[model samples]
Every structure is written in structure tokens, then in C-alpha cells.
Target chain A: MTRLSSAQRHLVRFTLNGKPVQGEAEPRLLLTDFLRQTIGATGTHVGCEHGVCGACTITVDGELARACLTLAVQIDGCELRTVEGLAPAPDRLGVLQAAFRRNHALQCGFCTAGILMSLDHYLRAHPKPSEAEIRDLLSGHLCRCTGYTPIVQAALEAAAELAELSRSDHRDV
Target chain B: MKPAAFDYVRAETLGEAIEVLAQHGGDARIIAGGQSLMAMLNMRLARPKVLIDIMRLRELDRIDSTSGSVKIGAGVRQAALLAWPELATSLPLLSKALPWTGHAQTRSRGTVCGSLAHADPSAELPLALVALGGELHLRSAGKQRKVAAREFFAGMMATARADDELIEAVSFPSGNARCAFREVARRHGDFAIVACAAVATKDGVRFAVGGVADVPTARDWPRLEGSALDDALNGFAHELDARDDVHATARYRRDLVRLIGRDLVREVLQ
Candidate 1:
């Protein structure tokens, strides 16, 4: 189903969020450029651009990847998510975003979105994580401002809050 | 940080990847999970005119055990291998060393053969592979060859693999041994300044050192039993030629080579 188009350009088609999107790009086009420039999702930041920093992280087919390194044409049959597409709807904060707000997880807010995306996916899979586990999971993410304590606290608080909400849902059911 | 413009080819099968490598020759670079290659490409340390992505070669992504050997495909990711309970129970040295290679996110994309190809002397997998006495499988157009782990690693960031060949899988025998890996690094997740993997078998013990050699070294064979181990442990400090690094001094690395080596020997033999 997948084959090389030609030397210079390759046409790729895949769904971004709930919408079908397609693009023709140079073979050297990074996925970050395709997302921010071609697809206009500015939520994905190109931090470090060299993969040393995790600010360029995004979920590709439910796995975290540095979008700056992944070529645009590589995700032809993949599901991609940038922080801009994170909310239930546009311009709205999701559970992780709201958790950051209430728990003061962000300061300068540059790395917050990528952290949220990574943590959001992690929390969805793991509704509750211990403090050490939180610290361990956040090793890849670096936040110069908040000292990471607040972010760690935010994740813990969010996990507890979500557990309480889920417990109430079970009782109501 | 844009990579140089090049042709992109997705190899659906390992054969396709081999053919692409043969056709493209020196112009090609094979990417398994793009963990190390991507970083290198961005830094301009490595630039190839053609990239052959072998990530979708599902036929090559596997880990299995036979009667006396365990086979691990080259395309197996580091995180996947770290999560393998079987490997942990069977090969704890590898499990202990995986976290020392890179951060969790990077390890999620890094692959075994990818690590071998990158051949960072500070890397943990190579030392572990050396102590484990593994074999490397190399394949090219119409030819396949096997190289012992001791032979595959030639120098810094180098391997015995031909430009037109790709690693297939690594098979290692279980020698009824107890293995352990230890290291000192700048931080918990950073690359090791000095690391060692030690395996103790019925006949003898094997000690492999990384981060100290241009290429990692595995020695201390012929079973330094009892007084011999004590002598080595006592004077092991002199055997190393460690160079200064950002995280450690040459003298400190030399001492650590002995100290950690002795402790690991104790953990293995006792």
C-alpha cells in the first residue's frame, strides 16, 4: 500500500484528529514543519530541533516521538496529535490543562503543552501514578521555571482528582 | 536543523531494505526507529543521500527463545526490550544497563541493531552484549555472514558490517550465569562516563568495560578464582587507560574500573 513516489516529492494522506488531511512535501520536510507550516498547528513547538530536548514531542499513533526528527511522509497511515488538537473541542482546556491551571503546573508555559500532551496520554493510560513514578515519567521533560515540583504535584493532584471522579461515576452507575 | 535533501524509501521487507542498501550503496543510511540516526542527521554528523526506513519490516521485529539460545531481532526497540520480563529474568545485565543509555522518550524509539550500529563506546548495550557472548547476523545481497560480538565491534562508532549489509538478529547462548551491570554517569539518565558488565559462569568470569575504550573491551576471562580475583581486584586499578571526560577524571575512572569491577565480581561469584 505504501511505496516511494519519486526523488523530490512524496504525497502522504492521513487523518489529523478527526479530519482527513493530505499533503505533498519534499523528502526532507520535517513533520514539525508540516504540522506548523503546512497543517498550521502551532501547538507543536520545535525545541532543540535536534531531539535532545523533549519540547518537540508529539503522539504519533499513540506513541511519543520528536516531531522535529520524524519525516512528514513517514506517518502516511498514522494518527497524529499536536497540543493544538488536544482539547475535546478547539480553544478549550482538557483535563490535564485544567489540572495544570488548578495545581499551578506551568510558569513560563513554553514546555507545559508538550508536558501536558505526554502526561495527558500517560494519565489516560494510567489514571493513578505514585510520586516516584511521576518523577520518573517526567525525566524526559525539562521545565526551567516551575522547578518541576509543582508539575509533579499537578500530576499527582490530577490523578487523585480523576480517581475521585471515576469513583463517583462508578457509584452513580 | 533541517536534514539534507535526499530520497526517502520505505523498505516493506528486510529483503527490500537489503536491495535498497545494495542499490544505493554508500548513499544510503538505514533507519530502524530513528533514535540515534535522527539525532546524528540533525547534527550533520551523518549525512546520507538516501534513507531506507526499515521500521515497517515487521518480519524482523521479534524476540523469541529456543532450547538453548534466545534470539532478538535487531529492530527491537530499547523500551520494548527493557519491558521484556523474559530478558530481565534471563539477562539482568541488559535490563540494568538499558536505562543508562538514554532518557525514556528516546529509548522508546531506539533499537538494538541501531545501538550496535551507532557503536557509542559509552553505550550500555554493547558492553552487555559483549559480556553475554552474543553473535551478530549480517545480511547483504545474496550473502549472509555471522560475526561474534567480540569481532563485530571494531572501534568508536564503528562495526564490522559492510555498507551494503544490515544486521538481521543476535543470538546468544545462556551459559547458566549470573550477570550484573554498573556504571557512573553525570546524571541518572545521561550517557555513562564509565560502565561495566560482568558475567560469572561455571568455568570463569567475563568483565567488559565501556566508556573507557575507543571501542569497549571485555576481558577478565579464564576465571580469576579466589586469590586471583583478589589480586585483580587489588591491582585492577592499574589495568585501565581511562581518559578524562566531563563527568570523571582519568584516575577516577581507572579506580572505578577496579572498585565497580570488584563489587560486580562479588555480586556474581558470591
Candidate 2:
């Protein structure tokens, strides 16, 4: 058993956004703080620290997780992806981000980071998701802006675009 | 909100975790998924001196069905169980209720045993356990014991589990016991204001209600119809002793228990 006392910070190493990162965290330090403060990946926003708002949503080992609910020390040796990893390039937006822009999916943008992360992970698994399915998935996220209609539209449009891209890629192959 | 400072222990084995629990007792909290506990920690509802991470205990992640019951281990997350291929056929009640336990994000990390350990009155898992007559397998450093779901949950946020004992697994009996579930909540993933689950029994149907009582309570009834069934449901609803809270009023809960209870029992019976 590896026991770290609460009196001091301990070394925590993990892969963030496909890049290796290390930090020091006390036992009580949440992963949300670690990502933003220690790793300086501020794209993962924190809305409700109690895991209700879903603003801290991210992927740990490819599975969607609430960063606030996860302790920083517990994420050692795991592959994590945050909202920072969503866009393929810093200068350009990804397909989903572009879709959100076109559909006017976000307003305040406090909840967009988490919603995008969730949709990114969800759309990958469900390429042909129905509007109801997208709505159901979005239930985890609480959005005050756009009333979620545009968000759903953006997700469906993105899914269709991704499917078309995949089909075209297969043809080229 | 931030959690109070605590020591962290990543147990390499079940014996190690049990030993730590045996030493620290109530001061030590075992964390698998931390979906519920983390919230408690952040809100300072649970301030343990030591948080034991049992997620690394791969041996405890099994979902065994060889014994004719679906035995889910402690490390088995809610999403894993929901994604189980035989879940719909083997444990239909869980299939209907798991989606209501939490959202997809939290379910990916929330464990089945963890939810039972939290023992929230409005949680769907405990209600399903009680309605299905499941068993909770608890272990300490010295010994292990199996607890009936009905007897295991003592009250809201409470259980019969000793501080030194960790829930190893929970087994739900797999059979064609026609069952149905329904919950009334403000949001899709919010805690239920009133949730009901019914399963066909030998003589009749057993109705289990959550979010109204301090604990999920189940009562079995012989086949009855019309006003007779209505009377039984009314009695059961009153027996829950619900109170007016921010989410719902006592009268509203009682009405739900009677209305949803009647619907679930009918569905299961048919």
C-alpha cells in the first residue's frame, strides 16, 4: 500500500491530453484544481465542485469522468483528456467546435467546455446518434444558454459530418 | 468547496485495504468511484482522516453469474454493469434502474457497491436491491458476512456495515421475476422525489419505494384488485412516513407512492 500523509504534497504523474505531466498534490486536492493549477490546463472549467453541473467533465483512460469527483492523487498513471485537447490545433477549431460555431450552440460558454468534451467522447462511440440520444447524453450537462436546442443541432450536424468524412476516407483507401 | 485534508492510501490488495480499515476504523473511508463520496468530501459532509482507494483491486471488479445470481464486485462501475451483455436478460430490474442512478459521466466512475454503501434514500440502486431481494457481501479483516438488502440499509445515509467492514460485492438473484421501475425527479439525473419498483412474487407482487422513506422499504402483497389494492397501497404509502422537503411535499410523495406503486405492481403482474 502506498500511503501519503495529508500533511504534505506528493508527486503525481499522469498523461494529460496525450502529453506526460507531473504535479504535486495533497490528498484532498481535486483533479480539477490539479489540471488547472498544477498542469496549467485551464480549459477544463469548474462549475459545481460537487459534480452536479458537469462543468469539470473530462476523460480519464478514455472514460468520461467528473474531475471534481476525482482526487488528483488517484489519477496517477492514467491517460486524461480535457477540453484543451478538443481542438486539433490551437489556431483552428475542430469539426465539433466549428459545428457549435455555426449552430450558435453556446452563449455564456461556462458549460461549453464540459459539454464539448462529453459530446466528443459520446459522438465517437455513437456515430449515428438520434436526436433523443443526444438529448439524453446532454442531460449530464446543465446549460443555461441556447436552451440546449442549438447544442443538440450542433451535435447531430457534427455526427453527420464525421460519418461522411469516414465514408470518404474509406473510399479513398 | 474543498475537502478537508486527509491521508491517501492506494491499497495494492484487498487484505491491505481490510487491514487499513481494521486499524483506522471509522476514520478511514474506502473510495472506489468517489462519485458520491467526493461530493460529500467537497461539501465537508464526510471528513475522514484517511481515504483508501480500492479501484486498483482488479480482483474485485468481476461480475459473476455462475451461481445463478449476478454477483457484482466492488470495483465494478455502474456503466460496466449497465453495459453487460446479459444485464437485460439476467437482471432486468437493474437495466431499468441503472440509467436513472446518474448521468453517463458519473456512471462511468460510480461503482455499484459504492452506491449501496452511500445508502441514499433516493438512490435507485438500493431500491432495486431491496425490491429484488439482493444480498450484500461484506468483509472485514477477520471475517466476512452476507447481509440481506432489506436489513442492510438502516436509514438515510446509513447501513448495517461496520466501520471496519467493506462491501466486497452485491448479488442480485437472476430469474424471470417480472419487474418494473419508475421515478419522478426534477431532472433526468437528479435524485428522485419518489421512485417505485415492483417485482412479481410467488403469491403476488412486492412493491419497493424510495425517496419517501429514510430507507428503501419493500412490502409484499397477495393478489388484490380495485379498492382492496388501493387500501393496501395507501397503508404502505402512509407507513413510509414521508416529510415535506425542498423537492417535494409529504402529501405529494404519498400520492406518488400510491399512484406509481399501483402502476408498477400492475405492470409486473401482467
Highest-scoring model, DockQ: 2
Please identify model 1 stretches exceeding 4 Å from their true place: A1-7, A170-173, B175-177, B221-239
Give the CAPRI class of candidate 1.
medium
Give the worst 10-residue stretch by lDDT in candidate 1 chain A: A1-10
User: lDDT tens string, model 2, A1-173?
Assistant: 99999999999999988889899999999999999998899999999999999999999999999999999999999999988888777788888999999999999999999999999999889999999999989999999878999999999999998899888884210
- Clash pairs, candidate 2, are none
Q: What's the residue-level lDDT of A64 in candidate 1? A: 79
Error of 1 at A123 (Å): 1.8
Cα displacement (angstroms), candidate 2, residue A129, comes to 0.5
TM-score of chain B of each: 0.93, 0.99
Model 2 stretches astray by more than 4 angstroms: A170-173
lDDT of 1 by residue, A1-173 (tens): 24454465777787786678888788778888988888787888878877666787888888778787788988987988778766766657666677889878887888876787778767777887988877776777778888889898888887777778787784210
Question: How many angstroms is the interface RMSD of candidate 1?
Answer: 2.4
Q: How high is the lDDT of residue A166 in model 2?
A: 87
TM-score of chain B of 1: 0.93
